[model samples]
Target: MTKQIFKPRGQNTTRAIAANVFSLCFPLFLVDAVRRVHPVALQQFHLLPPDGADLAPGLLEDDPRIVIASAWIDLTDGPVVLHLPHTHGRHFDLTLIDTAGEPFASLGTRTDNDDGVDVAVVGPRWSGEVPHTHLARRAPSDACWAVSRIHAHSPLDRPEAEAVSRNQHVSSLGRRAEHRTDHVTSLEPPAVSSLRQVIELGPAVFFHRLDSVLDRAPIGFERSVRPLIDQFRRDLDGPPPVSSWSPDLAEALELGFADGLAAIRAATAAISESRGIGWHAVAVPQHDESGASLAQAGRAYSSLGAPAREELLTLVCEHDGHGRPLRGDRSSRLRFPPDGLPPVRGFWRLHTRPTASGDKRHGIGDRNDLSPDDDGALSLIIHDLPPAPGDLGNWLSAPHGEMCLIMRLYAPRGEALSGAWRMPPIEIVDLDVDGSRPGGASSESLKPNRRTPS
Candidate 1:
């Protein structure tokens, strides 16, 4: 008998991605997210209240505009019922993602349902009848996540958002169980549980973790690659197992893992930039090819659980209007023409992230306080330090080296989604201490998994 040799896969994402790399790379990040998924009380969301706002700067991507109520659910026990109280017209959305990292379904204001309804989520193996009071939501995997988002515009709307968040909850039918969603706070160090930690587990040890997380039969395009995973596992389980792998085979697997990681970290997926401002406006969870799993896993590591595209269209700006990479050391200005605010039924916000710089400060000021200038143009300045004294509330902050800005439209109108409307861009200006501005490459070296325009 002879051992099978694993063929070498393409290392470049610009070229065709190797099938084997897709199979191995896609599941690695999902297992990372699943490991952190825990249940929270029904209708209760984890957040820092207004008074505790000082502590929020330490958290990663902590958007104060929305309250999150999420949980890790499994159908092996039985079907579960998700309770959603009426929103009373405040924006809210709930997305259901399977263990394979696919977003299967979404519900909320985007779905045209302000009046709340109970949703019964069942797995493929489930054979029970959903009670007439609930809408049946069948999941691809037995293990899934119920991620809910409630609109909260800080100090004013936060109390109401918290109230609405408490009305949304998840309950399992078996054992009449009520799963608990984990409590997330700013006090905990993210490195201890971040998915990035799994990136260095190495192929052999990494595959074992992926195996434990494939709790349900693979579905969708994942089914096509399931055979390869099973064969690899069986090979390892046989007489020699991990020790039996030839050096050539071990090296090939290691390269495949690295290649897949590159694809994920780069977010090499096709991005249609809105007005070429380097803002990626994506309708996520595209399930056309095997790459869907890769995308889902990438989002899990970067975005985690975002609302459905219809309810919220998130635009991320990595570079400036000229397609030049945004630099934190250089100050910039973003000007919106008079009466040109983003049109939305719910609300809009521009979150300026001054990432993990030396000061480690985050966004300051709210989008609500923005007003037009004397000339009828609304200009917001971006800099590492306050542009002016006492007017800090009007400016945006940027990281010391790199820059990122997220613009969100809750309940966006038709024009915003269609090509009819486009957002203004950020232009780098002369604001260094020497008053000299320098321009360089088209992009920065940041490799966050968030998708960006090609």
Candidate 2:
């Protein structure tokens, strides 16, 4: 007797459409997740002051030792050349972010240009001869962002670093780029944007924007995804077409959008479990294929423009060793054992958020003038007040209300990149037995996890 095979009815009908629609919207949700973080104006290269004075909310990683010249770039027309004046002997790194909000390329002391040089960034669609003197880099996405970091060696070097950073400029290929309004961009509000808004835009708008951006710098993915994305592109676009499917299926679209968002959020929460003591570190994967997977999009949404692990490892501490949340109203101490400095070829910088008082403190890693204990351990007192009359650099300011610390390990290799080197816990000090007061270890502090900056 032959067995009968049962096939589901209308497998290629509404059910299939719904699944494809769901699949299409999930990744787009991640893309916009990256984009909403693209807050701040399209203003080119705004210089963040070393003291972090009048800081706006949502600054990811900032400090007194570095000056950042940040700007939003568009490659809709063609390739654009990023220009940096001669650095002479200053350490600098310029990171370019793609549409997915991932740092696709970096140029400066770590990669190339020990001194300085012109670098032309060409997208997938652009084809032209870059000037022989300029280094040409092929980018994965047309919509990009530029974040240039210049290190300030000392009090005397800040002004020079700021000047050098401000001198950087980007020139479009061919004729002067006449700004085109049709160029694709994220939700760029004068203020920072959240993920909810982007998700709310739903499948229609998100897919449209994705198509426009990919037109300039298309990233090819695997069979399962590439075909669906292309099908939607073709169906929604035409000379004479049934592309406008929104009005007819408005109700279905809304319901699907709501259900998809709820499902994705629940799944994401289960995935982002607390993994470390008090520090939360997110590293961009080495080969994150564009338009290929969910992890790449998720990384961009969480860490935004963070560089790859080989170049930098950013760690954030919002609490202390006792599982107590960090509060800005109190004080704390970050102690490092002798030979404890993160062993990296380039350098390491510790950033304290909302603590403007200790902006003038000396080098965080200048061991020559450091005052260490007999055990060779170094402890840096963090408070809103200044250190003693003639004490060598050890005081980091605490904010009046809230706080957190950001540590960047540049050129991380060996133990630092591996799980071997652990982050030193922040000692919550200057509190009473009941968690109130100032002076000594009280066991309470304001080091919220790395995200929004006050």
Candidate 3:
């Protein structure tokens, strides 16, 4: 035959190589797509204040706290769509507190069923007579729309059924009002508009409605989102110039992606390890006359860089002769003059728990009985056995050999970071013996505990 056919050489090999490259590039494309779409989706439904109203603070820190006095959520429509964009699996804790920060009263559960325990509603009054309402106490979901200011004493219908029936009622009212003969007759229910307002506004609107009650914005979104804006700007404009896309740039892109993935994995691991594991303390002794200046200490600590940073628990002991370096002991009690208290800002909380070793002979109170100082500083005694009347504040029942103290500073003020704020050291004041109390060992007399660089 006259025709010679030429078969391409390395066809399978070329195809295999192409497939591998595609596999690598495909994930990059997907990640970029996700990143682009996610922010857009979040922004689309971001809650905004009503026409002339001011924006409320978003959630702050991990634990979002808000104070609401009184407000009405107007769902102008009968049915509302509450979109919980950020809340994937977590439930919401919707609680109403009195002006004095006390729980108003027990309202029925927000969700009809107890399938989710994250979201809940607390009001002055909630009874079982209301339709589709549960009295069980639990949390609510991210997205929940409900009729606010419902007369707690009034017999209610099932929440879901009522929500539906309320829609019908509104429609009936509109029709009746259209044909009303007497101007004196009231054709519509008084609470209907308020309930409808909630339905029409959706989740974003509902959040804003609650924010109006406080005359402030939601705190969560502000903290989380504002940081990202700065980060994005820095990424786009700061430092080295961003390179343009090219076939030759693929290698660099892949390497950068690998580095980012590694960072994400490291962060995830660190978060997992730190949860409820106990406290970490970082102490930097001051030398200058101005004890308020943190410049020297801050620079010194920052020079050591991120690894040396310590997550402050709380200030246990301040200016007492309790000593420079604290001695380790088994007792849970602490004795200090009120004047030498550590400087704290915002809110501070203390927790007492047994050491990891699970020894019950130590002194420290369990979670229930932490006594705060006269100024809201936590003051309690530590002892193996229960303390006498004089040592009432000293009962810290910890394990026998060793224990720890955790101090949480929420919304720390500038002094906390600046050298201006100094946390007093925790000194071991006493330990329990065979049916008697013994004074605390001195830091010098006690065995030297190794000081790890924080």
Model 2: per-residue lDDT, tens digit, 5-76?
Answer: 111134223223433444334444444444434444453455644432112112344555567665666676
Which residue pairs clash within candidate 2? Answer: 318-447, 326-445, 326-446, 326-447, 327-445, 327-446, 328-446, 383-398, 430-439, 430-440
Each model's lDDT comes to 0.56, 0.56, 0.27
lDDT of 3: 0.27
Worst 10 residues of 2 by lDDT: 1-10
Least accurate stretch of 10 residues (summed lDDT) in model 3? 51-60
**lDDT for position 65 in model 1:** 52
Model 1 accuracy (lDDT, Cα) = 0.56
Which is the better candidate, 2 or 3, if ranked by TM-score?
2
The lDDT-based order of candidates, best leading, equals: 1, 2, 3
The predicted structure with the larger lDDT, 1 or 3, is: 1
Winner on TM-score (1 vs 2): 1
**Per-residue accuracy of model 1 over 1-454 as CA lDDT, tens digit each:** 1112234335432112222434344543444444353333222234434222221111133465566655566677778777787877677778876655556788788776558888888887678677787788888776676767676645467668777776665676533345333333312224334444555656666655555555453465356555655565454343135678777656656766666677665553433355345667744543333434444545544544555566677777888978887776666766667677777876777766554342222343334466455556666667665544433445665667776787878778899888588778787764333342222111121112123213
Residue 193's lDDT within candidate 1 is 47
lDDT string for model 3 (1-454, tens) is 1111111135232222222222222211221211222232121111111110111111111111111111111122222222111222221122222211112222212232113221123222223221232233211111111211111111232232222212211111112212111211111222322212322332223222322232211122223322432343243232122244343333433443333333323433343222232223333221222111112222221111111112222333312233332222333334334453433332344433333232232223222354444454444543333444444444444334443454545334556656455444344443222333223322222221223213
Query: Using alpha carbons, what is the TM-score of model 3?
Result: 0.28
